[model samples]
Structure formats: C-alpha cells, structure tokens
Target: MEILVMGLNHKTAPVEIREKLSVPANEAMGFLKRFEQKRIFDEQVLLSTCNRTEIYGVVQNHAEAVDAAKRILCEYSHLDLASFEDKLYVLKQPDSVRHLFSVASGLDSMVIGETEITGQVKEAYLAAHQNRHTGKVLNNLFQRSLKVAKNLRTHTEIGVGRVSVASVAVDLAEKIFDDLKGVRVMVIGTGEMAAQLLKAMTGHGARALIVSSHHEERARELVREFGGEAVPYELFEKKMGEVDILLTSTFSSHCIVTENQVRSWMRARHDKPLFLVDIAMPRNIEASTEKMDNVYLYNIDDLKEIADKNKALREGQLETCAHLVQAQTQYFMDWLFKEFNSKIAASGS
Candidate 1:
C-alpha cells in the first residue's frame, strides 16, 4: 500500500485558484464517494480550506492513484488539469507523510505557526472517519500527525507570538484606523475564522460589534459569547453601510456581498472609508469591490503579506518543529509497513 497526497496551497496558488476547489464539507463527501465509485483508492480524506484543498488516499499503484485523483479534482473544480497542474503537487509514500505532518503542525501554513490548521486537519480526518472513508493506515497517520502538532507547540516557541491570521488581519485594520476606538464593526459570518477574527478585533476595543450569520442560532451564539448584538443575516447589506470595518468569513457557496451593493453602500455613507476583510475561502465579498473609492478590501493573501513580517521571528524554532514532525512521521511509517508486512505474511506471500 502507498500513502499519497495531491493538493495545492497558498504557496503554490492564490485565492482565486484555490477558491474554485473550496466547496463546503458536505460537498467534499461527493469527492470521497467518487473515489470509491471509481475504486481508485480504498481509503480517502478530503480537506478544503481558505488556503488549500487536498486529497489523501492509500492505494496499491501510485501513478494510477495520482492521475485519477487529478482528474477527479479537475472534474469537481471544473478546471482543466493542464490549466492548473503546475500548481498541484503529488507526494508519494514518506513524502506524503512528511507533508501531512508539516500541515497538521502548521509549519506549512501562511501564518507559519497558526493554531487553526490543526483543528481544520482534525475536522477533515473526523469527517472522513465518520463516513467510513478511512482505514488503519490513514487512521494511525492522522492520529500521529495530531500528536506531532501538540509536541511542536508544547516543545517550541512557535506559539509565543501573534501567530494567527486573525491577529494579522486585525493588525492591518489597526494600522489603517490608528486604533479600534469608536470603530463600528460588522462581521458577516459564523465560521471559526469569523469567531477568531471577532476575538482578535474585540481585544482592540471596537465601539460596536454587529454579527450576522446565515444561521440565526450560530449568530446568536457568537453574539452571546462575543457580547455583540445579533443582526439578521438578510440585513447585513443594510447594516454594513453603518459600520467602519466590515469583516466576512462564511462558508456560503456564493458571494454574500456584491460589487454593486458595496458601491451603493458607499454612496449612502457619503464616501466614509470602509475597511473590508474577507477571509472566507469562497469569499463572501466580491473581488471587484476593492476598486471603489474609500473602500479597502483585503483577503487572505493580503493578510499573508502582513504575516510574513513575523516569519523571520519564528525561523529559530523551525529546527525543533522539523525534528518533532520527522520523528512522528517515521513512527507512523514504521507502524504502517509493519501492518502491511503482517497482512502479506498472513496470506503466505
């Protein structure tokens, strides 16, 4: 059996490219089902987020699995393989093991040592596990990968700084406004990114917090925890014009705010500056809205630019993180091939 990973991340591709493959988790189940339907790989897990989308599988033949996974991802993304193949990386065996360990440990993230990727990786694995798409090999691999993350965090200084994209986004907002004082904020989503962004911005002391969610219950929960006043999802458009900072991080499949809508809102505000931060994978705000007067729009890639400033600070700890992940990867591989050898011997091979 072979461990394989096919994916693209913020390093290899930009948001516009990655977003095309950023379907909701429910939709990712279809990718797993297709892999099963084609009998390409018996074990599969799909992970999609703001920065990357990956397909993990264990198969007998590496070439066949890689080609099939590429075509399947192209079919799901409606993108031609030749068009995006240069951005995709196909990792095999121990390399795939190393890649996943780096990811779960946040070494591969744009934020360098973000805590969010571990949770995201765990969610992806659990979803596959509950759907019965994972087996012993991947089971041990993911579980070990998680432990590697904890070991790196506990043993190193990677977690000691402003190491989250949310904090980076807030840093940019503060630079723009000088401070958060009396800055009205409207956050239009209820995902984890939304919560983190809200938490970071709240620490700066915003004058108001208006939260809207596609699901009312989640919005109410955020409001209660963040001490924000909940607003109806449909009214986000109307309320957005009233705030100085507009942050959106939702899992909606379509744009929640359009260019035309923002143009209209700007007119109603008499050209007051509106700082918009859209960290959602599919992007809740339209891309074209960035062109309008007094309208500042920043996405995940923009936040990455700010985060790069602190990457040098964490480089001193990379050796420690690498050693931990490499040790974990080897541990997984030893167990993986041991199981394979046992199965082969049991069959009298």
Candidate 2:
C-alpha cells in the first residue's frame, strides 16, 4: 500500500481557503465513512483545523485518491474544484510519512511548535479508528507518531520559555490570582481561542464564567451548556469590571476594548489587576492597556513568539522520532511484503 497526504495548510493556502475547507465536527465522521465506501483508500484520517485541511491515507491509487479527496474537500467547502485544485499539495509514501510526522510534531504548524496539532492528530486517529477505516498500517503509524510527539515534548526545551497562547494566558493569570476557583472570567467573544482559554481555566477549577457576544442567543446557549451567564456585547465593558479574568477574540476590524475603556473599568474596581488575554489577530485589546498598572494584557503575537521558541527547541529531537517512524514503517512494509509473497506462493502451489 502507498501512503499519502493531500491537502492545503496555512503555509500553502491563505486563511480564506483554509477556513472554506475546514470540516466541522459533526461532518468529519460522515466524510471518513464516505471515503471508505468509495474505496478512496484502505484507510483514511482527516485532519481539519483553522489553518489546515489534510487527509492521511493508505491507498492503492495515488492519483485517484488525491482526486477523490480533493473533490470531497471542494464539495464541503462549496468551491469550484478546478479553481481550488492548483492550491493543494499531494505527498506520497516516504515523504508523506515525514510530512505527517512533522505535522503531528507541530513542526509544520502555522505557529510552529504549538501543542494543538497533537490533539488534532489524536482526534483524527480516533475518528478513523471508530469508523473501522484504520488497519495495521494506520494503527502503527498513528501510535508511533504519538510516541514520537511525546518524546519531542519531553526531550526538547522548546516548550521552555513559552507554551501555547492558552497556557500563556493562564500562566499570567496564575501569577496574579492566588486562587482561580473564586475568580469570575467573562469571555467577550465566542471565538475558538477564547473558548479554549475558558475551558483550560475551567479545568483548573474556575467556576464562575460569563459569556458575552454579538450573537447573544448563541452566547446564551453556550452559557446554558457551560453554566455561565450570557451578557450582551453592549454590556461587555460594564461586565468587564465584574470579572477577574477577561479574554476576548472577535472578527471585528475595529478595536473592541480601547485603553481608555479598560482604564475606566479599572476605576470601578479599586485598581484590581485584570488578566486580559487577546488572542485575536489585529488584536482585540488596545496596545496601551499593557502600560496600565492593573491591566495585564497579552496579544496573539506574544503567544506566537512563545510557540516559536518552543518549536526551535523541539527541532533537534525530531531525529529520534524519525528513527521511530522509520522502524515502524519498515515493519509495516515487511508485513505487506510477506502477505504478497504468501499470496504468490499459494497461487503457484
């Protein structure tokens, strides 16, 4: 069997293309099953994030497999296949293995060395496994990939100076708050990064949460599920002073929270330090807020620096991972050879 990866990433495609191809959670399993039924591959795993949409597979026909995956991706994205095909990339066999390993290791991430891809990899693997689309080849590849990733994290100091944007937000918060359980965090927007940061804080025993968004109804739904209150976007600054930690990420082109706005909120709270994490591009918080005494502000660029530092540290340990995948791939190839030889012997006999 030939292994391959076909897709576009943040490096290859812009955010516009990436978002269009991104698979939603509800549609992922169905897509995998459809690929299996079509015999597009012997095994298939789809990895879709904000920055990438990739298919890792073991297929009998590389060209057919690439075409089918591309077709399905285009259908999902509602794009014209001819228009989007030129933007995609396809890698076969050994190179595919190396590419996937690099991806799972976060070496290929837009923000190189982020830990999010490992979880995305695991999710993709699990989706394939659950649908019974994975065989010995994929099973070994994913298991070995995970092990390699673990080693990269443990052995490398890349994760040293900084971690993820979410972790950095929590790190700054932890330093300010003696206890997170009592603090209230108001998430100003329903964007993924803000949700992720809030979830991280929730896992750390943060109990009080208030979700505010332009779509108040959706915010109410999330609030109901997560057991938080829903405040309207108009009241975001009003609620800002009430919450201990304020995290914001929205698609707004203009500033949502200005330097003057945060300062005005500060006056109501007796100068209590507020942990604000801005994970939005173009930034959600004003730059001047960083200069404020009680306002600790972190932007996306700052978190990206942390991810880059960790990536540089992890690059050195990838060789050991390379060996691990090489050994596993050789084993799979050997089994494949043995099976083919047995088939030939039986036919001759």
Candidate 3:
C-alpha cells in the first residue's frame, strides 16, 4: 500500500476556496466513510481546519484515490474540479509523511509555530482512530506524526515569541490607540478562537472585554475565563459603542455584522474609531465596512502581512525544525517498509 494525501491549504488556495472545501469535524466521518465505500482507501483520516482540508490515506492505488477525492470534493463544494484543480495537491509516500509531520509541527501553518494545528491534527487522528477508520499503516503514521510534532516543540525555539492571528490584531490595535489602558475589547464568537482573541487583548492591558456568541453558554464560558461581561448575541451590537476593538470568528456563511448595522453603530459611537478584526474564514464582517470612515476592518487575509513579519522573526528556528521533521519522516518511512515486508513474509508462510 502507498500513503497518499489529497488536499488544499492556505498556501495553495485562497480563503474563499479553503472555506468552500472545508469539512467540519461532524462531517469528517461521512467523508471518510464515502472513501471506504468507494474503494478509494484502505485507511483514511480527514483533517480540516480554517486554513486547510486534507484527506490522508494508505491505499493500494494512489492515482485512483486522488481522482476520487477530487470528485468528492467537487461534489461537496458544489464547484467543478476544473475551477480549483490547480489548487489541489496530491502527494504520495515519503512526501505525504513529511507533509503530515510538517503540518503537525506547525511548520505548514499560515502563522508558523501556532500550536492550534497540532491539537487539530490530534483531533482528526483520534476521531478516525476511534471510529475504526484507521488501520496499522495510518495508526503508525499519525502516532509518529504527533511524536515528531512534540519533539520539535520541545527541542526548538519554534514556540518562542510565537505570533498568532490574535497577536497580529493586538499589534494593529497598539498602533491605532495610545494604549490599551482604556480600550474596551470584545470578541463576538465562540470556541478557542474567541478565547484566544480576548486573552491576547486582555494580556495587552485592554481595559474591558465583552464576550458574545451565537450560544450564550459558550459566551458565558469565555466570560468566566476572561473576566468579561457576556452579552447575548442579539444585543452585542447595542454595546458596540462601549467596544473599541471587535474581533469576529464565527461560522456564519454571510456577514453577521452588515454595513447598515455598522452605520447605526457608528452613529451611536459618534463616529469613534471601531477596529474590526474578521479572523473567520467566511468572514463574519461585511467587506464593504472597510471603506467606512473611522471604521478599521481587517480580514483573515489581512493578518497574513503581519504574520509574514513574524515568520521572518522565527526564520532562524525553521532549519532546526526542518531537520527534525526530515529525520522523523525517514524513521517512519523505514518502519512502514519493515511493517510491509513482515506482513508479506507472514502471508507467504
């Protein structure tokens, strides 16, 4: 069997494309099962994040697997393969293992050294493993990938002064205001991304925080952690004037914060500056809001510029990380070969 990966990432595709192709954790098992029923893969794991959607597998026919994965992705995204065939990546064997190692180690992230992807990788692996979707080859591969990721973090300076999307927003916030001493920061979303933004904001000495989410319980959870007020989702806009910086990371397909609402909010603020950070893939804020006066809007793509600067700062750590990944990948590959040889020998006997 051969190891194969058919996917797209932030580097290979834009946010719009990535969002279209992204498979939610709830939907991953269905996709994995589709591949099994289609006779595409012997072992499979579906890994999806805001920046990437990758299907990794151990299969007898790499070419057939790649073709089927593409067709399935086309059907799922409601777009033809021709529209994004150029963006799709199909990697085989040792390269596939190396790519997984790099991704788990955060070397392949939009913001290098961000720790979130490692957890995502583990989540995807375990989900597949628990569902009995992964066999000996995939089990060994994923376990080794996690080990390699841990080793890199322990041995290298990759985590030192790590810059994330949240930090980038904070950096921009610092430039806009005299200081965060009196700034009222609010995160209008749920999950760790929401918590991350509030943590970064508060850490920068922001004076207050308002947590809001589609679910009040999730909002309360963040409020409990961040020492903020939890505003119901419908009422968050009413508190916009009290909010100096508003970061949005939601799963909404359309803009939750629209231009008309912003107009009213600005009137309420008396045209005061309101920094808007849309870190969500589908973008929770209206794109045209960036053109409004005294309203600063930055989307996920905008964060990349600042992220690139951070990448430069962490460039020194990359070579060491590279060496670690290369060595671990080779070890995994050797073990794979040995496992395959032993299986063949046993079958012959």
lDDT of 2 at 184: 85
The true-versus-predicted C-alpha distance at residue 85 of model 1, in Å, is 1.1
Give the winner by lDDT: 3
**lDDT by candidate, in order shown:** 0.83, 0.75, 0.84
lDDT of candidate model 2 versus the reference: 0.75
What lDDT tens digits, residue by residue, belong to model 2 across residues 102-168? 7887767766566889999998899779878888778877877777667666765433544566766
- Those runs of model 1 whose alpha carbons end farther than 4 Å from true positions after fitting are 164-199, 203-310, 342-349
Kindly provide the TM-score of model 1 when superposed on the true structure, using C-alpha atoms.
0.62
Q: Tens digits of per-residue lDDT for model 1 on 206-240?
A: 74455655577887787777776888776766676
lDDT of 3 by residue, 59-82 (tens): 776677788888889889999888
Q: Which pairs, if any, clash in model 1?
A: none
- All candidates in order of lDDT, best leading: 3, 1, 2
C-alpha lDDT of candidate 3 relative to the true structure: 0.84
Query: What RMSD, rounded to one decimal, does every model reach?
Result: 12.8, 7.7, 11.7
Better by lDDT, candidate 3 or 1: 3
- TM-scores for the candidates: 0.62, 0.60, 0.62
